[model samples]
Target chain A: MPIQAITPDYHGEVRDRLENFHGNQLVYVGWDRHLLFCSAVAFPLAPDTRFAQLRDEAMAGVFGLHPEWAQVDWGRVSWLLDGEPFEPMLDRPLNEQGIGHKSLLRMQTPDLKGFQSAGV
Target chain B: MAAKKLNIKDKYRLLTRDLDWEFSYQDRKEAFPYEEFEGIKITDWSKWEDPFRLTMDAYWKYQAEKEKKLYAIFDAFAQNNGHLNISDPRYANALKIFLTGVSPLEYQAFQGFAHTGRQFGGVGARIACQMQSIDELRHVQTQIHAMSHYNKFFDGFQDWSHMHDRVWYLSVPKSFFDDARSAGPFEYLVAISFSFEYVLTNLLFVPFMSGAAYNGDMATVTFGFSAQSDEARHMTLGLEVIKFLLEQHEDNVPIVQKWIDKWFWRGTRLLSIVAMMMDYMLPNKVMSWKEAWEVYFEEAGGSLFKDLARYGIRMPKYAETTEKEKEHVSHQAWWIFYNYGQAAGFHTWIPTDKELDWLSEKYPETFDKYYRPRWELARQMEAEGKRFYNPGLPQLCNCCQIPMGFTEMDDPTQIAYRQTVYNGERYHFCSDGCHDIFVDEPEKYVQSWLPVHQIFQGNCGGPGVEDVLRDYYRMNVGADNLDIKGSPDEQRWNAWKGVA
Candidate 1:
């Protein structure tokens, strides 16, 4: 339903527009079933930043603390982009792969069922 | 013959209801412009019942008496060194959360009730709102005075008003009140008075006040006792408002129901902070968050909805979801705080062994299976000279403004992520309730000053987390945040107790 308001044309200014981030867009990454990290970690990344740089450089710092981080094979890990299954071209920039601002990327490790299968 | 003396009820009617003059020179629609915009139909203003009958003179006298008693207790608590009498220094962290997150909300309630008091067409509701407005003002003042003694010795209590506007976690309570205040007058009453004060106020007050009494904090407990009568009046006003709206016109039922649904969900999400305080922060336990929900919400709220059934009102949407969520929300909330301790205003710690055992016993079904191992790992990491803190900022829900840390109730392990694209931008929510609220009023939520997004956009003070925490949030840095185990608060408590 449309909002019941005093005025008919009640348009609010969106505060977190992509332009507000100084050329970088917000991207969220969640390791599926890994409750240890609590929520998805949000990162500000340029559209031209390659997927490999995100995978190798940024993700290691966020997900490396888990005991199972080292054992997971990136090639075999399945991925979901904004809730739909997707395959990212590793060498390509994020925008080319259709990952936009505030897009969520969920990575699932099939065999590594999070530390004793408890999801932590 | 002398004029007959007036009784309390006659005096109340003479002073309050009789004082409202009819609009002889101006249009009634012009006088109350916002009444029709929200789609509520009021057939007659005269149908509104006076919720509380206290006239101005009586109201002032009653409040002044409560103030005298309350301030006397506050003075004695300070002179007696009450800070030293708490069950544990960790109990102080709960007070920090209350002072920063909850006290400002009382001020917002004051502003909301004051504005609504002027906008209402019914004089009875207007007077009721006016009295509640003053009560809210007094509540905030008394709350701050009660907690002022803690500010001298505590780290996080120093810059609370500044931090409430800038901090990441404090935005949860801020946005809740902001959403209600910006709404129309009738919606504001249903959102705050009925949904929050009537339905969920017990979940907040009972635990915090009882916890204060159990933990030996006389100042907070006295303030709680002083505010008790006012809260009862506010709650009675809430019930009267709902019943009056429902009985006045049949068209008003669906609108009021929608407000109840939206605000009840918002109230539960905001109370996630209190859930953590009850289960983990208190040195002496009151009851588990799950148990409190059963007694206060399921039992008490169940009876309330049953009474409203004749008006075609049903239980609030997502109440079933809230029932399943109570077991896990406290654990999940504390875990998020523990992970981001460095950025928070209050200190966090791994729960002591006795506390862990207590949690295990309280949550028999899920604790050992899911949460116990995580705490064990944190404890092991601490012992091995490696204290873990999440380096990255958490993604926040667009509606609630809380970090999207809550997980699916059934799965318990998978994070519950919900999103929708509106006007070419993606918005996220922690649950369906929050998502539905945004979908209903995307314009209102779109303007949210989400702290994480602001930090990443360079709109917060600086680029780094520490810069934002120290400069933007005005936190005392090393003194205010991080683990409580080795904190200056703990050390001071130990010294006061003469422990080497």
Candidate 2:
């Protein structure tokens, strides 16, 4: 399984500084004690790349912040893709038509069995 | 090339050109991630209402106006001896951290939106992302201009862009945001846009303004307050996301529920610091962690989560624990700052007896037992004029990255421990997820170069508090917070706020 990442188009030596952290390390930044964001720089050859997967999984995490992806230019974006560079869709950005919003991940498949609600 | 200037309304029309395209590669099902969670039924994505209704034009128009207002104030603050207008510089330390750690994140949000604007599938989402993409960039630029005054007064700030990369505590936020940016578009929205903006924005902005109001930092307060007004709109976007997702498909319910859980925990864990800052850090104060929790999470998110329960999302998984743990996390983060502020980029001092009484009232259950006995001991040490730093590295939580102040849920006081053998050496964590991340790849997380440990290693200024504070973080002998003047950003605040 290859690493999938969406590096944003940001400048400044800050990104360069992240690259300076040795191989495969988690770095955190905060506003006072509140953690504003987090990421781990990992090498692919390193085993058990769940962080890689979790990182990819975070894409759907910001659903409301960005409900549509087609309006902006995606070409300029850059992020570590599995420690190398691999865009989600190399030729086609993920936001184009034909991708139904419902077609995303299988969110709640109606278990009717497993999960239990509290106030019931 | 300067993207040709067009009115924001016309700007949308220009960008909306050649609007039709075909999706041929993968089935629609394989594309978006959170289609179904519990039982959400989505009849329409078009129904999603951006409360901002912000086309690029109105966005820029209002945005430009906002900046114009900021600049008028900015020029005056800089010219009118505004730095002298404040109560003390201790108040500015909070602003310094904001400039370093948070302002950069605003820019990061802008970048996330730029990527999201291009990656999302719907026109509404794309436009919204583009709007946010632009708004966040404006925020970053404005905040930097506002706080640049401190460049003349503070030390560590000058190198923050450099420090955010290599610094230890910074990894918490860097990894958190990058986690969202690398994930699918919807998850990014849920994590960064929704949970952070809608549910928790007030937690961040409210205190900063109050802190400013408390301190004589009127300019800082004014800018922060003006900016937070925009946050109301962002929060709407967040609320809209959860609502729209739950309404979309039954399948979306469980998925959105999972997101609510994952994001809620992630955001809450990160905000432990905010809890501390709000309750303890400011020289003056506002509501306590308990009070803010009651209003924001319990009243707002607490109820919001229940409403979503109608859609089967249930409150965030960590809700029960978070509500309980606030007692501890709030005290711990502040104590860390209060105890270790010498090594950090900021300053901390022993809480006055008055402040301690407030903490006991605010935190109630935990403060007297778990934290204060030790704080009193420290106060004794300081009275004896002897401060204490542990001789060696105390264990660090692999996930949250604080020295493992965490314990099992049932017994909040027990030190939670999980360990693994890495390179034939033992590593530790307070939770399973952190242990998993560390064990999965030790090379990635090890050598976090925590600020306290750096001083111990002699990698920072020799060994003493003075040396470390002055050399590394750019503090001086007399410049520490305790020695500062005029009511710790509180007395002047009363003058400015008109409330005694």
Candidate 3:
């Protein structure tokens, strides 16, 4: 396993550190501590300091943190589902009949390599 | 020697249609098998006319040129420090997975097209199939050869042929295409040519090529764009197949409608992965899945389906399902990428705030409210010096290898998990049909090749994630390939952009 599992507490900490460390830039955060990683790339794996156990917790999902699914506050910005500029369109129907913005903006960023190997 | 340019207009004289010799020896029914299986009747074989009307001579000339261009790229990249030029080996993870999971389908297309060449009763259809067969093979070869440059540096490429057969998530596409290839030639055309080619071509080719354009993957961009030019031809074939079938006899309408319904859902479910890739994976996302689907499926396909009303064909059966999931494919695919990235040869990291803001603007409905909180909480965790990961094994959807986090269409809030108990073992499935398939034949499915399972089986470079990264991905530990690789296009891009 290339990663260690972490509790929600530690997972939360890592997310915070990832943001602050990079400021605004995208950076890596995982359940492993391996600074020995090569530093020559555009994006370097964030140093695994706080969760030293992550490197060993591979299948355990970084200490098995965040068990529940990522919850969505649907009513909050439900109108965004309507295909129009925000301020005026959040109130539009959500895939109400045919064309709506909410149905169009669904997005994902899969780790190129992670996706392939997961089904093993 | 440069082949003479043959005018496409003069196809009949060149094709030797005169050689058909009027089928003197054999009965027509024996020659054509399964024509009546669907109860469709064809009065005239001469009625069908290929839209492109490409002759063999014109076909090979352009094809040979495409190969010549591709091969030159291979030679240049290999001779130079192509591997050295990558922004980082981590970026290769995308390519690695792409080769293993998607490249094989190109070959499948070859087989399907080849079968099409022979099975098609008409000369025009047969010739069209012959052309497509060769093109598909070329796609597979070029993809393999171009990726060979990474072989010395990466490990996953070495195992794709093996992975494609055994992986679980791979089954989604594998089963989809397999289902089509197993069906009649007409069905194959409907499944791939129409459902996939016309309905979702933009989702597949556009993002891949456009993303390459944005990320500075010149070779990939060029190759992708080149291949897509052929896709336009395939799209035309797809459109005509449906239109021709429907127009031939009123009977074909129902069969065509059934196929449209069945295959549309199948294709949409399969594309969920690509949707995720576009919305999240691409550093420079173009349009979100929800947006693209709305335009492509709803606006375009929707309009087409509406137009079909006059012809007696109704809307896609699972149109509701597709419409419902459109808002969530990107959301789900990204989360899956983040959580299950360990076994993956590629790297997974969080999106930036700016990108999140982009998501907010793009998905005005669910951005800051539901999705934002997850990121916000993650941001808070990061602020406290932490990164999150799921605590336990995700409940796998029996149908799709994706986790059971996706819920029923009408209610996106609930996690959807449908189960079917067999003789002794209880099999978990993502939906009813997937359960039905598994129930029908369990052994065929148990032998799936999921990447995560492979990691546990020690099929990868051994237990360490870091080890897998180095061996499987040839990951530079942390890097993305961009201008440094100097894709032929990138070199030109800089020269044109007037940058030194």
DockQ ranking of the models: 1, 3, 2
Q: DockQ of every model listed? A: 0.81, 0.02, 0.03
What's the CA error at residue B189 for candidate 3, in Å? 0.9
Q: Candidate 1, after superposition: displacement of residue B314 in Å?
A: 0.4
Candidate 3 per-residue C-alpha lDDT over B322-366 given as tens digits, one digit per residue, 9 for 90 to 100: 777777667766665555444343445567778789888888875
In order, the B-chain TM-scores come to 0.98, 0.80, 0.79
Weakest lDDT window of 10 consecutive positions for candidate 2 chain A: A29-38
Candidate maximizing DockQ: 1
- In angstroms and one decimal each, the interface RMSD of every candidate reads 1.1, 17.5, 21.5
Per-candidate TM-score against the hidden true structure:
0.98, 0.67, 0.68
Which residue runs of candidate 1 sit more than 4 Å off their true CA positions?
A: B1-6
* Alpha carbon lDDT of each predicted model: 0.92, 0.57, 0.57
List, residue by residue over B72-126, the lDDT tens digit for candidate 1: 9999999999999999999999999999999999999999999999998888889
Query: Predicted candidate 2: interface RMSD?
Result: 17.5
User: Could you say which candidate leads in TM-score?
Assistant: 1
TM-score of chain B of 1: 0.98
Candidate 3 global TM-score:
0.68
